[model samples]
Target chain A: MSSRREILDLLRENARYTTEDIARQTDFSVEEVAAAIEDFEEAGIVRGYQAVVDWGAVETEDERVRATVELNVALDRETNYGDIADRIAKFPEVTSLRLVSGDYDFDLEVEGDSMREVSHFISDKIAPIPEITQTVTHYIMESYKEQGMEFGDRDDDDRLSVSP
Target chain B: MTFEPADRVDQVPPSGIRRFFELAEEMDDIISLGVGEPDFTAPWAAREAAIASLERGRTSYTANRGKRELRERIARFEADKHELPYDPDEEILVTAGASEGLDLAFRALMNPGDAIAVVQPSYVSYVPDAIFAGAAVVDVPTRSEDEFKLTRDVLESSGAAEADALVYCYPNNPTGATMTGDELAEVAAFCREHDLVVFADEIYADLTYEHEHTSIATLPGMRERTIVFNGFSKAFAMTGFRLGYAMGPPEAIEAMNRIHQYTMLSAPTTAQYAAIEALDSCWEEVQEMTSQYDRRRKYVLSRFEDMGIDCFEAAGAFYAFPKCPWDDADEFAEALLQEEGVAVVPGSAFGEGGSGHLRVSYATGLPDLKEAMSRMESFLE
Candidate 1:
């Protein structure tokens, strides 16, 4: 039986392990390893690959204030959630969007130092849209963990592997 | 293709809490005092109970409301501690945490456009959850001079008598203030007169240093109108276990349980078992931890005072909200974390009237607290 440990062992030994290498390590046939990899990918056990870059080379600001903007929009209006999301997506500062079940229709992630920068984006750029009715912003004070390493480091072996 | 996509769903904004947390994550060497969680591990009895439950093959889901014994223990605890008698079978429901309890209460009681009167500088969840429930929130700001206490005057001034619900948090979160028996009686009277349903969060009740926590439900005529929310997370140091309960009138309890059944069948079974043990054998441990927190609280208050920061001694909870010498708490917190490696949440994070203050959690060990205070002193200097 192909156990989870065997699969993880193969991946840990070589994150870029080919099907042949996996088969050699786990004593499975190349075709079987390839099929298993396909299954893992489909199950989202293998997420996308990332190229590690040295922070010294990036030259980007390391830290700034982060806030979530919850927006309420008019349903029948021309400037709908899609229109507003598209507009927000174009802004370099907007990081992500999540559709939540309650309160607001959409939650936007924005980055800046001063409230003025955030207010300017909300009042001048976002709120001016005809479909947008109201917005509430919650500034995050401190985070114990963030998206990348913390989420990726879950003990569960349910993540997908993606080839670079 | 069908007709063009809807305009509204795309127009919604993002979450502000998520953004601030990201900046907090980036700062290196920052000693965060901003987290809401208590630093202690789950009491040994509770932890052992959970382990035993898992070993005994009780990993599957419990009843939607919760394990019978756990609910019974909660009911007994409430009746004994606060004199709020509740029938476990009819008047208590388990939730993921007090957070979920608050959410379930709102969902069960509020309809769109209903008004929810919330005390300002309260837990971040109340107003947001009220908004999420499609209710307009009317904020009643309490003064620092009053130690941020929620008095009957504040409730009356907010015109919450006409509101569908009044939300209160005592042994409160950001500000560590609490209400006395007499104060709660006044609140109970106001709610009774106005026919307003009260959602009382007493999560930090067990941590009071100077005074005992008095539940509004304990007062005459208040049991029918008040829903008391308490949890193992704070008192038993079981933040990770995510167990809490609500006690209210049978009808309100039934409504909340319906939502709980649909959304979350129950709190984790292991957590329920653990919580049962917590109620049985965890009081002494809680008192010990509370003592430790009390010491840290005093130390932090004095340190802030020495640094020329104005602060009031918190009566309960493990936080110290100190007025920032700099007018902007967010900026001060950001600078402290970046320069001195000490992190505290900006007071504005809690809501209006919190602008110039910073919330410093004394939940860490004494050594860490000392180091953090020293760093804070240097930063202020």
Candidate 2:
């Protein structure tokens, strides 16, 4: 990818980069940097900054169970994967769905209140479709880091009062 | 209000750099490339330590030489990082920052009328501070033709051999020139031959780009004669926290403490504790910042070269000393600021032989550096 595209992708992860920092990495003129960022924002090419939430933080409260399901599907001129993929995306429990390469054509990240519920949703609701040829589901055992945040050690309150 | 310093203090010509800053303050759109401090915040680990200290009510005054535990940490840190060996209990005096440490060292070492040999194109404080300490300054110009190196030839030709002491800043300010251990061993040998004491400011030691920074004190027979001044300002980005230390022979440290205890009783107690944490765990942060600085340094130097400007390629520190294509730095700098709204310090602010150059700092982030370079491109053309 071009550096500008990479810059936007990096921005998606962290917006703390000053224009000077970006210009250095991107080999762009600092004079034109602010305008470029402004263009990105004004044209809705860039949206807003956000925190990447770790579902594990609130996992206990919701009894959240997440599973990654990989599927190999039949493809030809008569039908396309996008047709069924879009339909599968409408399910509220599916957090993310991507058309991947290799043996599996699609991978769906699904969440549910329990493993039994997720099992039921995948087996009873998704597999009965005509397009599906094979299915595989894997449950996440642990998350050491999520969305660029490290969670190895428990975090403590960091704020302190100022003393003169 | 009585506003009077010792009459001698009034004569320490104010920094020419400050004058350029006056113009910068008046302009709202100025893109500056003239800060000496790092653009990064203190790392989270270091800040976390300070917060922890404050929570424990660590706001009281520390020892005159700072907390013993901190001193030990400083000793270990220096030993581990630079192969410097000093007795922490007797040899380290933690000051407010390198600024205060420099002041203390000067006041402690200089007798009235003593001469201090200082390199030209040096830090602004060196000449003025030496003057304030009631010492005569022997200016030895380090030339761009010679890569801004203060060689034994420059020292001898300038009659600096007769001076009572010498000050050297490696990974130098304004120029960013650094020396190898072999080169410094030769200089250290010269200092020994002349019976000159050395104040080696290694504040920029952690920011060296392509080379390993060699501390002069590490050379044979030099440790006893050299006081290495370093702190948390540049390395750990703890400038406002005001943590610094001086390490040397026990007598020199004691001499400095005599003056230090009377003037400034202690460095910030909380900062002392925080610095202990910094010395222990902030190496990764320092490495990260140094890498960022190294990248910026390469880009800035490449841009200067691409412009066909003659620049001394500095392997250490975060400054680019580039010759201005003009008659004098002050006029050229003023014109650039007025015409392009870019602010940089005139090299003349440094010292003699600095007239045709400008000091551009890469301590600022890259975009500002890029903007400054682009503006200078048009300004120079």
Q: Name the top TM-score candidate.
A: 2
Chain A vs. true chain A, TM-score per model, equals 0.54, 0.65
In every candidate, what fraction of the native interface contacts is reproduced? 0.00, 0.02
Residue A161 lDDT in model 2? 10
Q: Which residue pairs show backbone clashes in model 2? A: A20-B366, A20-B367
Model 1 TM-score is 0.67
| Model 2: lDDT of residue B192 | 94
Per DockQ, the best of the predicted structures is: 2
In candidate 2, which residue ranges exceed 4 Å CA deviation? A1-164, B1-3
Q: Candidate 2 residues B106-151, lDDT tens each?
A: 9898998999999888888888889889999998888888888778
Q: For every model shown, what is its TM-score relative to the native structure?
A: 0.67, 0.75
Candidate 1 lDDT, tens digit per residue, B1-381?
898634432332343344556676776556667767777778888899999999999999899889999888888888888787899999999999988999999988899889998887878788878877878788887778878887778887878777878897888778888888987788788888888888999999898877888888888888888899999888788988989988898899899999999889878898998999999999899987886676567667766766888888788888888788798777887787778877777777777667788788877766667688888877766
